[model samples]
Target: MRLHHRLKEKVLESVSSVLPITVIVLILSITIAPLTPGALILFIFGAVLLILGMGFFTLGVDMSMIPMGEGIGVQMSKSKTILISLAVCLILGILITVAEPDLQVLANQVPAVPNPVLIFTVAAGVGIFLLLAEVRMLFQIPLSYTLVFFYAIIFLMAFCTPDSFVPVSFDSGGVTTGPVTVPFIMALGIGMASVRSDKNSNSDSFGLIALCSIGPVMAVLLLGIFYHPSETVYAPSEIAVIATTKDAAREFLTGIPHYAGEVTTALLPIILLFLVFQLLFRRFHRHQLLKIVSGLVYTYIGLILFLTGVNVGFMPAGQHIGAAIAQSPYKVLLIPIGMLIGYFIVKAEPAVLVLTKQVEEISNGSISQKSIEHSLSIGIALSVGIAMIRILTGISIMWFLIPGYLISLIMTFFVPQIFTGIAFDSGGVASGPMTATFLLPLAMGACEAVGGNILTDAFGIVAMVAMTPLCTIQLLGLSSRLKEHLPPRQPRAKEEVEDCILYFDAED
Candidate 1:
């Protein structure tokens, strides 16, 4: 009965979460950018899969990821063995990132490095940074100083990196911290911080995701310079030629197994790693182990379905619709349309949910979930607007990134420390699979139409999506900090009342 109840709740939540994007796309199709019958059918079927997939995925994270990360954190921190703890964090980071489905999609797009090489390099970057994040939290290092320093390194590296490699490098940071990584990493931060029992410990729990994000940027930037990865040419996105319902079904049927195999291959490493840890640590009780096992199953199935749907249904639609709009006389409309999609689509990102909920919980409700959602929506909308403009204009991403990061970094010192942490983490979370799948493809199609350099112009949508949140969420913090600093009104005093009464008597 409880199992059924849990599943039902997740299903309902997933539908609500996914419905807005579905409506937005449908509206766009019916009015402005008409979808072919085949694409429409794919969209509808994919929507169903998305709803189901999100339900399972979120619930699975709650069950498996949160507990597992906490357990690992607690045990590692309890030992107070730095070498052992760092090694564990490093291994766990690589293993978990390797399992991220979003990264798979990203890997396929970058042809300069072999898929495995790019994937592993990004994973190593994440692993190293996750290790750094753990160390920073343990030592009580300020998130701002760390971010400013590392990002300086990233920028320096970027100068030498080929134009084609720069966007992909920054984008790797965003996608690496998606659905698979966020929950576990955030929870791990919480668990580790719990061991400290200090005032700053709660704040310390946050910035792991923040720091982990930088590692990928830095890693990819250096690799790009070394490899000198060139522009990747790709065959056009596969369009579904659905003459009938049977063909639509056939496209989806064919797509599912491929994603299923990929998701399974990804999950296997994590499963084996967990089993090894369990054997050595024996941290979880029987009931807990059984529950985690169940959750992993849900996570696997959910990801397979989700990836299959997005790749099959959403990607083709995004490409076709984007090309159509860009080719039309009204090409400039891409900016607003992109903005509209950005505002809604971000809320659907699975990792964004993880970050917001975690922020609210960690802050003890000082940061409300509704406020985070609003901030993220506004930031991402602006980002997509900026990205579309770049796609049309062929501007360097650095034109925006340098100024954006400067503002964010400057605001960091002005806001409360925790807000800075959450803000950076929000940047990472906001650019999950949706940005990779829908928005990136949209930018690519438009880039193709405009005859712009796809690599340099269209590819930084994820990075832009990631950048805006750093500024906006910190602005939320800055706002809250100002409100707290506002002068308090004077209280009514008995002495003042007496003085007033005496003055009245004297006047009389």
Candidate 2:
């Protein structure tokens, strides 16, 4: 019954995400130009796959990844051996990040840099930050101070790195933590906090994502110093038309098994680790273990189907549309259009709604889901606008990132601690699979048309999407704090006497 309810909730959230994007596409097609029948069909198919993928991914996290990560966190914390915990965190961080699909996609888009080298460097960054976050939580270190120091290091590295690699470096920070990483990392926080009797256990649970994000930025910045962009041209490709629904469906169906294999490869290591731990710890019963294992299977199947549809049917259309629009006399409209797409795309982000709901529940409704969604939407809108400007003008991403970080760092000191943590975390969550699969390619298309540097101009949409949310969410936090600190109203004399009589009666 619990499993059934969770599945239902996952489906509803996925639908909410996919529906807005579908509506936006429909509006765009009707107003701008009629979409090719093939493109229209592909869009619908992509939406279905995206929602299903989100559902399965969420379920998988709940069943296998979350529990396993949390268990490891608790056990590691109890050891009270700093060296062992640090070693475990570093190794796990690198391994898990290396398998992240979003990061892999982003790496492939970066020109001149070797994919393997980029991947490894980003993974190492995550590992280092994961260790730092764990230590911060265990020792009750303030999140703001660490953020200030680490961001200072990042800014210094930005100056040392080449111009071409700058955007990619910040982008790596955004893409490194997505659907695959969030659930496991959040669960890990819960586990780590379980062992600490401090009043700030919940507070400590909030900043792991913030720290994890820093790892990729710093890693890629260092890489930027070593790597330079080559004079490479990216010519946009024309997508062939699919004549029939059966063709599209058949193509999607056939690729499912392949994706199944891929997701299995991605998930197997974590599953094996969980099983080994379960055997040693014997924490959960046979039935509980079986249920979790079943959930993992559901997640695997869903993800395979989802990825197959997006890559095969949707990506080409997104790129083509962006190129088509950029060549139009109304090319400037791309900014607003991009913002519209971004506003809805975030709704389609699989991990985002999950994070929002969790925040709402954890805060006991002090922070509402609607408020979080609004703040995130505004942030994403600004991000998309900024990305379009970059594509148009070839603006250096560092100019934006340096100021963005400075503002986010300063805000961290003023906002409630939990909001600061969540805001930083939201930066990463807001730019998940949807941004990678669609918006990045859209920017790439625009950059290609304008003869801009793809590495410098087109690459940082994900990072911008990630960065804006930090400021917006903290603003919401500041507002909440203001409300909390407001003085109570004075009672009228009659009302005060009535309250005094009621209090006396209660005491008697």
Candidate 3:
């Protein structure tokens, strides 16, 4: 029954995402005629795999990762030793981030930068900031104040970094918190908060992702200071045509094993840690262990299938469509196309659904899942629109980011604390793998055609994804606040109450 429910949710979310893309593709094919049949087929195939993979990945997170993260959070907090908890948070943050697929994808695209250095720098940033977040939560520090200090550093670093590196730097922060990171981090927050027997435990549980995001920005900024890549970097525009079953099968098979291996490798350390802790502490029940193990299996299979389909099918189509559109007379249509894709893609984001449902459940349905989804859709729409604008124009990312951060920071003061945390985290969670794989490449292809710097113009799709959610989600939060503060119905007069009771009894 549980499996059936999960499957239903996954299908609903995945269909919501793929249906829009399919509609857009049909419109483009009939009216625009830019996307070839082969490209369209591959894109559809890839979207299926991506959606399925996301579903499986999200399910797996529920089964395995969240439990493990929460277990660790509870255990670490129980120790009440600040240094131990801090070290654990730092190490786990770096380790998990090092394996982030989205960050790996971004690093591969930046030609001038060495992939390893970029990966490590981003991982290190996540590590340090994750540690900071845990500490802040433990100490009951003000989230807004920490955000102000760190963002101030990021802005300062932006000035020192070269023009080419700035967008990627901001983007790294967003990409680092993809599907792999969100479940664990969110669970960790919940777990840590559980240990706090305070009235504001829920509020304190919310801002880890916001803080973790700071790590990558600072790390990349520092990287800019040290490693200046002098060569011109451009992302490739050619699309690989997959015409035969052999091609699709071979491509899918090759990637499936690789991702199977990768997901296993990525998850092994956390699993081992969980085992060790379980042995030493004996916290969880036998049934819980069985459930988590089952979840692990689900996660592994889901990741393998997801990666296989995406790498084999989706990527080539994304590039092709973008290139074809760029060459079209109706090229400006890419903005709307991108916006449509972004809106649907949020539904496909594995963590977004989890976060929304969890929020609704946690808040006792004061915040509805429908409301959360609506806000995220609007947020992503704005992000894609802005990203398309960037691709078309050679606007520096800093122009948008500086103002966006300023607004988010100021809003933090006026809103409820829970809203601020969710808003900030939403920035990272909204971007996820879909934006990294499809939207970023779409921007890059546009940049390639217009003869713009790919890194500066195209790379910040993830940043836009990260930034807009801050505004949109907080706006939702503001709306919720308004609803809460609205005056209640005046007490019924004695005659009115008696009349109502009499009417009710008569109806009965």
For TM-score, candidate 1 versus 3, the one ahead is 1
In model 2, state the lDDT of residue 135.
86
Error of 2 at 190 (Å): 1.7
lDDT of 3 by residue, 128-227 (tens): 8888888788778888888888889889888998887777788888888877778888888888898888877887778888988889989988888888
- Reference-based lDDT, each prediction: 0.86, 0.80, 0.79
Model 2 global lDDT (CA atoms, 0 to 1): 0.80
TM-scores for every predicted model: 0.94, 0.91, 0.92
By TM-score, the better pick of 2 and 3 is 3
lDDT of 2 by residue, 1-508 (tens): 6877888888787888788877877776676635677777877887788778878777776677677777888987887578988898898788788888777777666657778988999999999999999889877899999999998998888888776667777888888887777877877887888787777776777888889999999988877676665532333445657788986787677768867766666677567667776787687788878878887787776677667766665676677667767877888988998988888778777678667876886678878988998899999999999999988987788778778879999999999888988898899888777777778778887778777777678877888999999999999999988988999897679988999999999999
Q: 1-508 in candidate 1: lDDT tens per residue? A: 5976898898897787789989988987997789999998998888888888888888888789888877878878887569998998899889888778778778887776898988888889999999999889878889899999998888988999887788888898998888777888888888888888878887887888888888888888888888777665434577868878789889889988988888787778767877888999898999999999899988878887788777788887788778878988999999999898889888778777778778888889999988999999999999999999998888889999999999999998899988998899889899887887788888888889989888788888899999999998999999999989899988879999999999999999
Worst 10 residues of 2 by lDDT: 229-238
Clashes of each: 0, 0, 0
Best candidate (score: TM-score) = 1
- Model 1: what TM-score? 0.94
Quote the lDDT for 426 in model 2.
Answer: 90
